[model samples]
Target: MINVVGFRYCRLGTADLEETVKFGTDMIGLETVGRENGSVYMRGDDRDHNICYFEGDPTDHTLGLELADFDALDAAESTLTTAGLDVHRGTGEEATARRCMGYINFKDPSGNSIDLTVRPFAAGRRYFPGRDAGIDEFSHIGLRVTDPREAEKFWSEVFNFKTSDWIGWSALMTFDEVHHRFALFPSDRPGIQHINFQVSETDDVMRSNYFLRDHQVRIQAGPGRHSLSGARFLYFYGPDEMIYEYSCGVRMVDDTWRARQFPVNDASFCAWGSKPDLSVLEGPDAAE
Candidate 1:
């Protein structure tokens, strides 16, 4: 069983680097750190960077998840190989993409590109938010799984992630300590469903909701609670049509915890005030 740690970073290709960086810092609450030839790095809450934007065609979107250690990485590579999945040892520039000592690349069953890395760089600097909204850390990822059943089995049986609950076909998953480091939702497209950042409280969600609206940013959904994790959340669209979420009050799970299974239903997915936003359900190829 591979012991994955948590979300590391997400890389997306953009036609304009400066526009993306400004949007990340000035609009989305991430602080800019550094920029190379064509790549811009911005971080939230002390990590060197949790999101990197690169100048390229708009089609590239990659997600990176860090394993616990080299042993875990080796175990992951072995697992992917044993599953007859193609795995690539990251080289030269690929290593720089994650700012890690080592990395291996592979695609999930849904063909979502994922990079597994060891020793991803975290700056030794303190984090002070450019626009404070009680921002804490990058939390779980919402992925557009082609088939939730197969995706859930792959993560649980192969990667050893434990399911916390199921909101219909959507699976809330985690490993070791964190509530849910990842989630799988059935969708027609093949890319990240949404990226979430956990905040401090419902106040933080309300704060961000008003702040983003005042700034003229689109409020996609929320300022309401999710029945799945029972977290208060706010989802807003960021640059490049990426969905950014701020949530609080996540539940945790360990070995003794039994998986809570629920049939896909509206009540289980959204609580009071969280109306379904079809924008989040749209696939990558949907009209922008």
Candidate 2:
């Protein structure tokens, strides 16, 4: 099993960098950490830059997750190569693009570009949010997998991601169970379903709830708690129709415990209040 550390960041290509940066930092509670030419790097409370946007057509979407060290990265390359998966060592430009010391880029079975980084850059300065949003860290991501079973096998067998729970065939995979660090669900499109940032309190959720709506940002779902992770959450649409989630007070798994999977059910998906009504069906920007 490849001992993965945690999520690093995601790269998105957008035609409007200025608008994207404004929306991410102002509304989403991420801090603008770095910039190089046409690319912008945004970081959560953690080390690695959590999100990046590059000047291009909006079609380019990629996610990066970190391995423990160079050895873990090397082992992943070997495993992928032996498995007949095409892997490319990131070059000068590619490494710079990733903002990591070293990296190898490969596609998951669903054609989503998954980047494995050895040493992702950690910012030296302290994080201070421009607003009062209580975003603590870039917690997890949801991906749209065309086939959840195949995606589950690829992440579990190849990458060592253990399953936490499932909604139907949708599998939530994690390195350590703060519920899940990544989730995969069957969908027609090949990209991120949503990006989540953990906040400090329930009040933060309430505040952002009104803040988002007042700012003309569309609320996609939630202002409620989830039955799975048990974290209070609020979901809304950000730039590019990307779903952004704010959640907090999640349960953690301990050393002696073994991972368990939960079958998908309506009650399990939501705890109290209404089940979320998402405008986007199962694809990128889908509600008509």
Candidate 3:
């Protein structure tokens, strides 16, 4: 297994870099950290950056995972290569661009880009938000997959991510104690379904809901509690139609916790009955 410590950051390509930066800072409340070579780096916590918006095709997105060290990274590369997957080592320039000491890039079974890095950089200074969105840190991500089973197997076998629970075919997975660092949802195409940030509390979620409404940002779902993680959430749309979420009060699982499965339904998704426009989870052909 790759022995991933946790999720590091995400790199998103956007046609309008400036607009994306504005949405990230103004709407999402991320602190702008740096800008270089047509990319803007933003952070929600002490890490140098949790998200990067660069000028490119909007479909180009890369999720980063932090490994313990160079040895673990090397083992990951070898393991993936042995499994017949193409892995590319990051060059010095590439590493410098990402503010990481080293990294390797590859695509998952669902064709989502992933980077495994060593010694990911963090700022010594504390994070100050551009707005009071009440963000705590960049949290889990929802990954759209054509085959949830295949994607789940790849993540579990390669990175040793454990399933915390299941809502239908969607798998809520974790690397550490945090409820879920990643989630796999069945979709026709591959991309990020949503990027989530944990907020200070339920009040934070409600505050952002009103803030987003006044700002005219499209609210996608929530201001309701999730049945699975027990988190209060708000999903809103950002630039390039990228979905961003603010949530709090996520349940943390321990070694003694056993994973449970629930049928894919409104009840499984939300305890308060707020519905999301999730076409990906609708059809009879949806993930098993």
Among the numbered candidates, top lDDT falls to 3
lDDT of 1 by residue, 50-123 (tens): 88789986557788888888888888899899999999989868787678988998888888888888988879
Tens digit per residue, CA lDDT, model 3, 156-258: 9987899999877888999999989988888887888899999999999998898899989998887889898999999888888899999999999999889
Per-residue lDDT value at 41 in model 2: 87
Name the weakest run of 10 consecutive residues (lDDT summed) in model 1.
279-288
Query: Which lDDT values do the candidates have, in the order given?
Result: 0.78, 0.80, 0.89
Runs in model 2 lying further than 4 Å from the true structure: 255-266, 278-288
Clashing pairs in 3: none
User: In model 1, which runs have C-alpha deviations exceeding 4 angstroms?
Assistant: 263-266, 278-288
Better of 2 and 3 by lDDT: 3
* The candidate that achieves the highest TM-score relative to the unseen native structure: 3
Q: So what's the TM-score on candidate 3?
A: 0.97
Local error of candidate 1 at residue 203 (angstroms): 1.5
Summarize candidate 2's per-residue lDDT along 173-225 as a digit string, tens digits: 78875778887856876888888989999999989999999999998777888
Between the candidate structures 2 and 3, which one is better when assessed by TM-score?
3
> TM-score of each candidate?
0.91, 0.91, 0.97
